[model samples]
Target: MTTRTDLLVVGAGPYAYAAAAYARDRGIDTHVVGIPMAFWRDQMPADMYLRSGPDWHLDANGEHTFEAFFEDRGLDPGEHDPISIGVFLDHTEWFAQRKGLAPDPRLVVDLTRPNGTFVATMADGDAIEADRVVAAPGVGYFAQRPDWHDQLPAARCTHTSDLVSFDDLAGARVAVIGGRQSAYEWAALLCDHGAERVDVVHRHDVPEFAKVSWTFVDEYVDQTLAHRGWWRHLPAEERAAIGRRFWEVGRLTLEHWLVPRLTPGVVHRHPGCAVTEAGSEGASIGLALTDGTGLEVDHVVLACGYRPDLARVPYLAGVLDRVAVTDGFPDLTEGFETTLDGLYVIGFAATRDFGPFYGFTKGCPSAARIVVDEMLR
Candidate 1:
């Protein structure tokens, strides 16, 4: 059977929720597909804390905001300064409830434009037709595995997303590859779970564990709404400077809360190092580092982070050949419309043109407003 809608959003995360809510409120028939916040619910660590605060939310209208949820629940924002994953999940659910957004919990297996309209094939062999498709796929599919990753036994190594819970890792030594926030946070969680040892190896020096301001991104997001193609039109050097600043703050600095959990003896930091060789050693995974040292751990966790690659999205396979891309990111217009006439991409995939903030919840409202405006036009 087939159903029809004016717009179909291909993800049910924060981006999808915001877009669908805004479009529906504006009198557009919209349907959202995919499990809501599946990544956060099933992939992230159980005790993870978000880098963003309550100011970030999935509300395009700004009425059902996270701060507003706090007020409704009689909860103090100060008590959740560094919001826990559970609190964020609750807020997202509350916002969705208030907006009356119940996404269809089915996977879109294939997407194609056989005729003038787009048809999305659901996993259950059902189809849905829409005037336009907005893909807001998450970064879970774009994991950046190292070159030597395949050399190690598959069972012995896993990405940070795949190994969300560290409960069974007690008494087991681990090797965490990467020095970013996720890397450090995973190491701390392992320590907290009673891991025997965790060697965090990376090519850079230890990042500073301090608080930093993210208010600078607000102006850039505001600029995006004020001017069309604002980010892409910036001078090359200016863009580079902005990227460098983001890297310095977001990547080169770790959260202060992790310091207490990442004990020196339990979580060892090996800076200026990279994994030279990896293989199985008896029951453990053996890794040789560039620092002339080696580690024999029960498991290896890769925190190399994600990159944007449209081809990795399975459902987009049918339409990917027709979609224009550069450096793995879709070429999007100021309104997030792709080269395809009725297809759009938001979230991480739109970062290349819309700016890095689009990959986070803070840009959800702006992205929803821009895309819905284009749809109406």
Candidate 2:
């Protein structure tokens, strides 16, 4: 079946919801397609808490702030200093329903450019056309597969993003690579779930990330605020390069908080080491490091990070090719528009154009304001 609308907002994450809400407020007939809260619901572990503090609740509309959601539900946000994933999900579900922007939970299978509109095909054989298309489908699910992992059999190696259950790692000695929040959370979760030992390997002497402070979020430190016009004049490649720098510069590693809570000897840290080879030995996996070290583990979890692969976002692939892309990520303009006329990207994908904070909960409101203004005008 084919339906049509003024704007088709793909993805149902914080970014997607924000865009849809803004558009709806302006009386734009916007249709949001994709699984609602898929990342927070599926990828993130239930036990994990948000890295940001309570004040950083998801608030696209000021009235629908995280605190407000909890308050409406007879809960108190102040009671939870660090909100759990479950609470965040509850807030998102409530917000989505309240705003009447809850998406029909389904994967967008393909997107193709028609004569003057975009033809979006869904997994269930539904189709829609829109005057403008917003590609906000969160991050693609594929984790960055490390080079060392190619030698290992598929079953023995898996990215942390792929795991839905810890039952497979029972009594296993697992090694997780990277020093970001995901890596630390995966290590903690594995140890909590009965893994024999979980080794967190990092290339740095210690896991470190930029300090998180509300002051840094202000205009002076976050260059995006100072140079909002920079993206429009620069070439796409240059813009993306600048965006990546901002993203890396703003993130705070989980080691800052998780290190103190680690159980003695359950989670080991291997600093200044890198995985160089991975192979399977019967039920175990053999991993070799660049530092002339080797370990035999039952499983390997790669938390290395994510790559913005256009292949997973089939709808934007052709449109993406027309625009400039750096390292497989879309190159967007200051307004988040691609080279394609009616196509725009938001959230992490728009970081290059919007700056480093584009993917965070805080950035959603500003991005929504920008996109809604552009679409309406």
Candidate 3:
């Protein structure tokens, strides 16, 4: 089967949904395809709560704020404790429906640029075409596995985003790598699930919390958005240098929140040490540290970080040479449009182009507005 639309959006996560909502409001014949809330529902741990809190809503328009959604659903946002993942998903679904932005829930298996339109092939044996395409796929494809991990078998090492069930590690010794929010949250979950022991390893001496100052964050956002043309005008080397600078200066360090949760001895801290190698031994794994030390464990959960791989994006490969990526991130225009005309990428992938706030919930509305205006005009 084949269908056509004015715009094709890949991914149904927060960014994709917001883009679709904006397009709908502007009277664009937009069609989005992807698993509904796949990242939030599948990747994130069920027990984990949004670190940003429920007050930080994902609503693009003010009408669909968390407070409003709660009221419309006959629930009190204030009364809810921790703001469960299930509740957030429910609210997203409700908001999507309320805005008349329900797109067919289909996984886009392949994307190809054919002539002037984009050809999207779905897993269910259907094809769709659109004048413009926006790859708003969520963050899972870019799971960052350190090079040292190649020594270990897949069975012993896994990214935190791949954890399907904590029960699988019952009574086992586990090493939760990294010192970010996800790392701490995964450790907490492992301990709660009866793991024999959970050790959190970090390259730094202590975990850091994300700097949440509104003024500082706002300045970072402005600087990032202001340099949208940096990728286009500068050489790849220069662009990468800028990305590293921004990452060092603007990104929140690990000590901000994760350090307080460490129960002195329970969560073993190995600061200033890096994982040199990883290998599996039957059901257990061995990790060689940079400080000439080794630790044996049954499982290793990597919360190291993420990077966008354009090759995984099926449709993007055809125009891969045309779309410039800086520091493994898509280089988008101020309006979230890529170098290739009619192709836009938002969310984390577009951070280098949009600014530091691109990945946060707050940036989604502005990104949606930018794309909607460009495509609907």
Candidate 4:
């Protein structure tokens, strides 16, 4: 089957939905393809909590906010607090439906430019052609697979993004690497599910917590939300260094509530240690570390999180060869267009150009505004 449109919004995450809605509103013929919120629905644990506050969500043309969804459903909006994964997923689906968007749900296998337009082939052999292509990938495309993990068998090492359930891991000794939210959250979840023992191994001494005030968000929406806010006019290195600082405070932070649940001894911390070698050791895995410590655990969970490297995305592999990239991210214009004409990337795909904000829902509105606005011009 073949379908054609002026714009192809590829991905079902917040970024895709926002782009689709904005493009359609601007009178651009847009077709969205991909399962809506597939990452939040499939990759994330069912009981996990989003680090974003209630105010953050996949909004449609500035109309359908998560707060509005809560209000319409007669539920308390919980203004400044974090929301559960379930609620966020529901809101995403509602945003899709409300915008009259029903994604094709088929995975894009490859994308190519034969002439001026682009062709996106799906796994089911369906074809789509569009003058412009927007790749709004979710976090899984960037799941961190530590290089050292290659020494261990796949059965023993898994990233936190890949786990659907902790049921099979019950009573198994587990070690979760990284000091961020995923590390602490997964450690707590594992212990709660009765893992024999869970170790949180981190290169850092402690976890960072959310510290940005809501006022910061207000300023962001009204004025400071672009490429690096005040740092936008700065040199690339300056912008990126600022991004690194921002990341340490935001993405690397742990949810305060997780600390209490991660009781001592049950969720052990091995901070400032590095795992140098790991391999199958009978029923368990033997992990040799920089601190001269060795661990024998049934499983090693990598909560190291994701890096938005286009090369890591199988579907985008064909297109990546031509796109300009700096520091593992696409070199995008203000409109999110890649070096290749008419080809665009949003969400985390635009990180190197747009900064870290593009990866989160909070940036969706601005992303939507930029893409559609540029498309019309």
- Give each model a TM-score: 0.98, 0.89, 0.86, 0.92
Best by the lDDT measure: 1
Colliding pairs, model 2: none
Q: Tens digits of per-residue lDDT for model 4 on 1-377?
A: 99999999889888898889878778889888888688888888998887777677665366888778888778775552557888887887887788778888888999999888899999999899999998887878788877889888787789998876999999999988888878888888897788989887888787755444433444444453444234255578867775776666675666676866786777778889978887886787988878998888999999887787788778888788789887778887777788999988888777665656666788888878877777778
Error of 4 at 232 (Å): 4.4
Which residues of candidate 2, in runs, are more than 4 Å off? 57-60, 208-215, 220-257
What candidate 1 gets wrong by more than 4 Å, as runs, is none
Ranking by TM-score: 1, 4, 2, 3
Model 3 local distance difference test score: 0.74
Whole-structure CA lDDT of model 1? 0.92
How many clashes (backbone atoms < 3 Å, residues ≥3 apart in a chain or on different chains) does model 4 have?
1
Candidate 3, 1-377: lDDT as tens digits: 99999999888888888888888777888898887898889888877766444555555566787778788889976667556788888888987888777768878776777688888888888999999988885678778988877787777788988985899888888898887667777887786777878887887656445644334444444444455443455677866765665455333343244445444556676777888878787877988888887888998999887777766666566678888877778767666788888889888887655544666766666678767876756
Query: What's model 2's overall lDDT?
Result: 0.74
Tens-place lDDT per residue, model 2, 318-338, is 465566677666777666777
On a 0 to 100 scale, what is the lDDT of residue 366 in model 2? 69
Among these predictions, the greatest TM-score belongs to: 1
Candidate 4, residue 52: how far the Cα is off, in Å = 1.2
Clashing pairs in 4: 208-253
Q: What are the per-residue Cα lDDT tens digits for candidate 1 across 122-195?
A: 99999999999999999898989999999888877999989898989999999999999999999999989999
State the C-alpha lDDT per candidate.
Answer: 0.92, 0.74, 0.74, 0.79
Least well predicted 10-residue stretch by lDDT in candidate 3: 249-258
